[model samples]
Target chain A: MNSVLPNRAWTFISLLIAMVFLTLQNNSSAAQFLPNWPWLVMMFWVLTTPHKVNIGSAFIVGLLCDSLLAQPIGLFALLFSLSAYFMTTLSAHYKGLPIIQQSLYIGLFYGLFQLCLDVFSYASKPENSLELNLWPVGLVFVFWGAVQYSLERLSRPAPIE
Target chain B: MFNYGIHERIRIKTALASVSAVLLLILDLHFGMMNQARTYLYSITSPIQMVSAQISLQSKNLHQWLLNQEAQEETQAQLESENRMLKAQLLQFNHLKRENKELRALLSVSPSQFATRYRLAQIISIAQGSGQQVTQINKGSQHSIHAGDAVVDTQGLIGQIQHTSLLNSQVILITDPNQMIPVINQRTGLRGVVQGNIKNLKLRFIPQGSDIKTGDVLLTSGLGQHFPEGYPVATVDHITQHNNSEFLTVYAQPIAQLHQSSYVLILEQGAQ
Candidate 1:
């Protein structure tokens, strides 16, 4: 049990580091290439470890991102938590589906997250032209498809296992 | 022991999650108490921001050096020719200096005072997150750069300092949706608010009958105590009017290339 401490600590540290990098990458890409879909990271985490990456972790990470981006606080936290919960709940029913189907599910959740951001930002400042361009949605779907395909291939169990 | 129904357990968890999310959203929206916490969290990430900014700075410097090498060679040749012409002009101006001074003394008017403007330069780093539309600059609080300092390039005002750490400050550009600038139409003197759009800045709240037209230059009105007075902000790009609306929807193209401005000046105001 004591020997497991280092492994656990390392895992926690790595997760934090990954979260920061993902948050940074998401924002950078949103400004440069596409609006970031951080929900994809939440989806990936949930699909991999449903037990560890729960609603609370999502909430904290979302809050951190909201702060980093100077977004309305708790907006992302709520979005992330809700997205993770919905994804986790949906995963049980869709676990047997093909990779494309799973990707579609993830893509919809990410789209919803983007929608919430657009709505909130627009509602906050009505005069601002917050046009909802579908390009970011398309980018998110493509990213989700790639990530899901890669993860599915990488996580396939061996016959002996 | 007997187990609870799996469906019931899942539903209960789902309900709980929904409730928590609603509660968090309500709290964040109503209270805004998380701002201090957010600032604290941002401070924690400052080190990573500093390192990234340093790397960006070095790369930008190298790129600038290579570009300047050829430009400088041509500029040096031009300057040598221009220097002779300017020297002759200076000689002619000196000849009239005595007559100008006598006129000045007769009018009992002292010479105009000029404030020295310093150019403090910085390199911009990659934005930290996807949602954040801010850039981190190499200067910070330690450099006498404070919050609300106007950042500009050779073209026009780019942004202002949003957050600062020891050696890094985040600039929220004028093109960000959250940013607003008080501006005046340089030609018509029509004052209005300049707002950031996704791609460019737009002039908001000009009355429908306002004399603002295409090709008018917009300068900072300096109404809000935030930015200084009379700096070029943007040029009127497009104007739209609707009969039903009280105000005209005016859009302006920012004079500065916001995405490409690597070096900027942080203006230091003199004591009034």
Candidate 2:
């Protein structure tokens, strides 16, 4: 029974979801250099188990993150919902791509995500000019392999009894 | 809706969530319709944020200590004393000014007002990579703190309380473009507006050859009534003028350790 809980996709995925709060809460001055860990974890699960973890859950989790990070209530919710939509639509072809191409694909969307964040930041006060820093997207590509590998191992199904 | 395929169901759900999120964002931004809800949510999450800030600060100090034990110890001492030294200097200035006022009063001259009220609060966490240049504090409306109160450190003025929740508040620092302070040249009593350009504070509209010069001191003019009078705000660090410009470009470094100070004083509105 203990082993079964680890193999249950929903259980493991929820645990990953819980870590999102901790990751965002612990953000420090160097947080700008760090990739958005919660987003990457959400993408992995939404891509793999779209049925169990749907857009609604993504939106709710994003709201919690917004609360924790002291951002506007729905800024991240909007982004997460849009990301879930795109990922759910692309999950079919995403798994077939080679590692390099997969990372590049992730990078493409990650760049888009960073752009949205920057735009929202400017919209904080329209008087402030927009600033675009997409270097952290590179960190997403760097972390892509490790995040994907570990999550896959954690949620791997148990062997036949 | 019930007859839709699985993919179609997911797409519909996504559309609903996106639309809902946009609506929430609009209401929250334009009307602050969600402040009550947001505050309640913050009540639950703020403790976690506080814990994270504590851990990060402790880890940073530990890292510095391990990496350079002697140097870190020296730097810690210097930081601790820096606030005390600035406070002492301001106190001496105030004492002399008060004595001068007393002497003038003896001759039937006008007397000026001075300030003494300040409430202390500890730093919680600073907003990261945001252009707003705001920092959250541990005290809030529950502690009699309210919006628009002028916040200062041991050294000088930092910013004003932009807003307050029941448990936390954010201070908009002097270094944000949106903030402007009225400052007087302590040496010559010349007045100018100090505005922030992201990284530096610029004292604006000083006409060419005004009595201002490099290393001159600037203090609050108390013209706006938002900030307390006579607090050391900044020191003139640089002055430049274009060959044909009508005004001299004056830049001053802020006296308050805006990012470094752990505790801050908020001048209460009613007290003033």
**C-alpha lDDT of all candidate models, in order:** 0.68, 0.78
User: Considering every candidate listed, which one attains the maximal TM-score?
Assistant: 2
Per-residue error (Å), model 2, residue B55: 1.3
TM values, all candidates: 0.66, 0.72
Q: Per-residue alpha-carbon lDDT of model 2 for A1-161, expressed as tens digits?
A: 12344434554455344444444443455566666666777888888887777688779767866765657778888998899889988988998998787788887888998899998888765666897877779887887888787777767666777
**Collision pairs in model 2:** none
What level of docking quality does candidate 2 show?
A: acceptable
Question: Where does candidate 1 clash, by residue pair?
Answer: A24-B128, A26-B130, A27-B129, A27-B130, A27-B131, A30-A34
**Chain A TM per prediction:** 0.75, 0.86
Candidate 1 CAPRI level: acceptable
Question: What is the overall TM-score of model 1 with all chains considered together?
Answer: 0.66
Q: What lDDT score goes with residue B90 in model 1? A: 70
User: What does the interface RMSD come to for each candidate?
Assistant: 4.4, 3.2
* Chain B TM-score, candidates in order: 0.71, 0.71
Candidate 1 has a DockQ of 0.27
DockQ, all candidates in order: 0.27, 0.43
Error of 1 at B5 (Å): 11
Give a tens-digit lDDT track for model 1, residues B120-160.
Answer: 76644544322345766777778887777788886888888
